[model samples]
Target: MDLPRSFTIRESSHRILNPFTDEKLATLGRALHLAPGTRMLDLACGKGEMLCTWAAAHRVTGTGVDISSDFIGAASARAAALGVADQVTFLHDDAASHAATDPVDVASCIGATWIGGGVAGTVELLRRSLRPGGTMLVGEPYWRREPPDQAAVEGSMATSKDEFRSLPALIEQFGELGVDVVEMVLADQDSWDRYVAAQWLNIRRWLDRNPDDELAEQMRAELTTAPVRYARYQRDYLGWGVFVLMDR
Candidate 1:
C-alpha cells in the first residue's frame, strides 16, 4: 500500500514532513536524555527522520512503519546515509494495527494520530507498544486561540472547532488518558511558514517539469490559494507540538 501520488508529489522535497525544523527535532532528542540502545517504535513515521536521527545522535535502535512506500524507501536510504542502517528499519505497512513485537523504551505516533482514529485512540494504540515506564511521544496541533466562527475554523483547515483543543485542554487530554505530560517542543509561526511555504515551491517546480501530469491542475489551484489561507488562518490560529508523556 502507498500514499496518493499527489501527497508524495507535494512533499517530495520534505525531509521531516512536519512543521518541525531539524534543530527542533534534535532539541527534543536531547531533552529526552535518550540512553544508548534505547528502543523506540514510531508509527506513521514519515521518511523515518526521527528514527534515523535518533539512531545516530542517541545510538538508539528503532523500527518505523508508514503507509507510504515512497517514504519507506526514502527512510531506508536515509538510515544508510546516516550510517545507522543497522539500528533502524522502515516498513511499508499500515500503522493502524501495528504493535511492537517487543515492548520498547519509547513509542511514538507523530502528526498522524488518525492512524488510531484520534488522540485518545492513538495514545491507547501506542501504549500497547510501550514498556511500563517507557515514554510516549505524540505530535499534534492545537488551537492557538478560539476561532470566532465556522468560517474561521474552515479557514484554519479544520472542519469544526472541535478538531483541535486549546493548548491547556490538550495537556488535560493527556491527563485524562492517564498519562503525565513531561516535556514538549512547540512550533512557531516561522516553522509553519517553513512547512507550508515550502510546498508551494515544490508544487511549482513539479508543475514546471510535468505540466501535463494528471494532478497538475489540482496542484496549480492549491498553489494559488494556499499561501493566503495559511498566513491568514493556520499560522495564527493553529499551533503544533511534540509532547512527551509517561504512564501515570
Candidate 2:
C-alpha cells in the first residue's frame, strides 16, 4: 500500500511533510525534554523526519510506520544520513493497523489522523500503543478564525466549516478525551508558506523532468493555482500545531 503517486510527486522535496519547519520541530523536541532511550511509535510518519531527528537530537529510539514505500525509503535514508539508523526504523505498512509490540514512551499520529477515522478515534488508536504516563503527540489543523461561509471553508481546503474547530475548541477536545494539553508549537503564516509554496517548486521540477507523466497536467494545474488559494484562505484562517498530550 502507498500514497497516491500524485501526492508523493507533489511533496517529493519535503522532509517533514507538514507545515512545521526544521527549527520549529527542533524546538518542539527540546521542549519535550525527551530523555535518552525513550521509545516512540509514530503512525503515518511521513518521511520519518520527526523520528529520525529526535533519535539524533534526543538519543531516542522509535519505530515509524507509513503506507508510502517512497516515504519509507526516504525515511530510511534519512536515518542513515543522520547516523541514527540503529535508533529508528521505518515500515512500509498501513499505519491504521500498526500497534507497538511494546508500550512506548510516546505515541504519535501526526497530520494524518484519518487513519483512525478522526481525532477521537485516532487518540484511542494511539493510546493502545502508549505506556501509562507517556506522552501523545498529535498534529492537526484548527480554524484560526471562523470561516464566513462554505466558500471560505472550501477555499481553506476543508469541505465544511465543521471539519475543524477553533483553536480553543480544539484544546477543549483534548480535554474531553481525558488528555491534558501540556505543550504545543504552532505554525505561523511564514511556516505555512514554506510548506505550501515549496510544493510548487517540487511540482515544477518534476514536470520539467517527466513532461509526459500521467499526472503532469494535474500537478501543473495545482501548481498554477495553489499559491493564491493557500495565501487567500489557508494562511490566514487555518492554523496548524503539534500538541503534546498526556493521560489525565
Candidate 3:
C-alpha cells in the first residue's frame, strides 16, 4: 500500500531526485528520438518528471504508475503545472502489474527494477506494454568495480549484496532478455554525487521540520551516516545508465 518514505520525499523535490542534469536528460530524449506523438509508459515514474518532460517535449500522451501515493500526487501536480495534465496521467499502483489500456510506442522502467525482480524480469514486464517493435527504456546501476565487502553492497541497497550485477554482465543479461541495447546515456561521478547527496539534504530538512516525529529520528540517523557509506562504497564501485532497448 505504500513505498519507502525516501521515495515519497524525493518525489516532492524533483530537482534533487533527478541525478541527471538537464543536458543529460536532453541527451536521453535525443537518443531515443523522442518526437511529437511518441507514447511512453514510465514505470516507477518518480515525481513524473521523465514522463511529464517527455510529454511536453513530444506533444505525446502517457501514463505513469508507482506504488507510492505521495509520489503519484506529486507527479500529478507536476503534470498539471506543466499544462500537460490532459496528456499524461499518474496512478498509485504496482509498476509490475500496470497493464496499459492501449499499447504504447515505448515503455520504460527507470531506476526501480524490483518490480520485475531484476533487469531481465523487469524488461519482460515492460515488454507487455509495448507495441510490436516498440522500445523499452531501463535505467539501472552497474558495477564500475567490485565492492570491497558485503557491507559496501548493503549500503548501496536496503536489500542484500545479491541484488545487483556487474556492468558487462548486466548488458549480457539484457541480451538474454531478447533486448538489443540500442542506445544509452551514462551518469558520471558528479551525477552520482548529486543524486546521493541530495537525499541527505532532504532528510536534514525533514528532521528540522518534524523534530518530534518518530520518522524524523530514522531520517536523522540515515542523514548522519548515508553519505559516508555512499562515498566509501557505492560511489566509487558503481556506475549507472539509462539504456534504450528494442525488441529483436
Candidate 4:
C-alpha cells in the first residue's frame, strides 16, 4: 500500500522524511566511515535522500525500497541528480516483501520501523540482509521524559506511554536484542521544529492553491491546531534518532 494522500501532501517538500536535517544526515554518513564500495539496503527509504547522498559522497552502492510510487519516482530523480544513478536503485515495493540478492554492509529501516512491527522486529528484519559485522540503522522515537498526563500522551501522538521507552531504556533494548550501540544522530528541538513546523507551511500553501481539493479542509484543520499541540506536548516529550548498531 502507498502512503496516505494527506501525508504526501503534507510532506511533499521534504527530501528526508524523518526529523533529520541535511547536515545531520551528512554527519551520520561520514561518521559511518563507509568504504568506497560499501553496500546498503534501506527499507522505507523515503525519497532516497540517504542512499543517493551517501552514494555520491562515499561511493556506496545501494538499493532503496518503498511502497510509494510518487516517492520512488522522486528518489530515482534524486539519484540521477546526485550523479549516483548507477550506484543506487529505488524500487516502489513493499519493504516487508523485498529481499536482497546479496548481503549488505548496512541495512536500515529509518523512521519506519513499523515495517517490521516495531524496533525489535525491524532489527531482526534488517539483520537478515546484513553481512557479518555490518551496521544496522534504526530510526525511531523514544520519550525524552515521562508524560505526566493523558493529554501529554495524546499530544505526543501516542495512545499510551507504553508505546515508547525512554532514551536510556531504548539503548538497553538494543543491548537486549544482541546489538551494540555504535553511533547515533539525534534530533534536537530545532531540528524537530524544522521538521514539524514545515508541515504547516506546506499545508497552508496547498490549501491556498487547492482551495476546493477534497483534503483541503482536513489539512486546514491540522494547520490550525498542530502547532499548539506540538509546543504543548511533542516538542518536549518526544526524542528521535537514527541509532547505529552492530551485532554483539
Instruction: Name the lDDT value of residue 13 in candidate 4.
Output: 94
Model 4: per-residue Cα lDDT over 212-238, one tens digit each: 998988888889999999999999999
**Mind giving the per-residue lDDT tens digits that candidate 1 earns over 95-214?**
998999999999999899899889999999999999999999999999998998887798888999999999999999999999999999999888888888888999999999999989
- Candidates in order have lDDT scores of 0.94, 0.93, 0.81, 0.94
Q: Which runs in model 2 stand beyond 4 Å of their true positions?
A: none
**Candidate 1 lDDT score at position 3:** 89
Worst 10 residues of 3 by lDDT: 9-18
Each model's TM-score? 0.99, 0.98, 0.93, 0.98
Candidate 2: minimum summed lDDT over ten consecutive residues — where?
1-10
If candidate 3 were superposed on the true structure by all CA atoms, what would the RMSD be?
A: 1.7
| lDDT for 244 (candidate 3) | 90
lDDT, candidate 2, 82-165, per-residue tens: 999999999999999989999999999989989998889999999999999999999999999998988779989999999999
* Steric clashes per prediction: 0, 0, 0, 0
Off by over 4 Å in 1: none
Give the worst 10-residue stretch by lDDT in candidate 1: 226-235
Q: What is the lDDT of residue 97 in candidate 2?
A: 90
Model 1 TM-score, 2 decimals: 0.99
Question: What overall lDDT, based on C-alpha atoms, would model 4 receive against the true structure?
Answer: 0.94
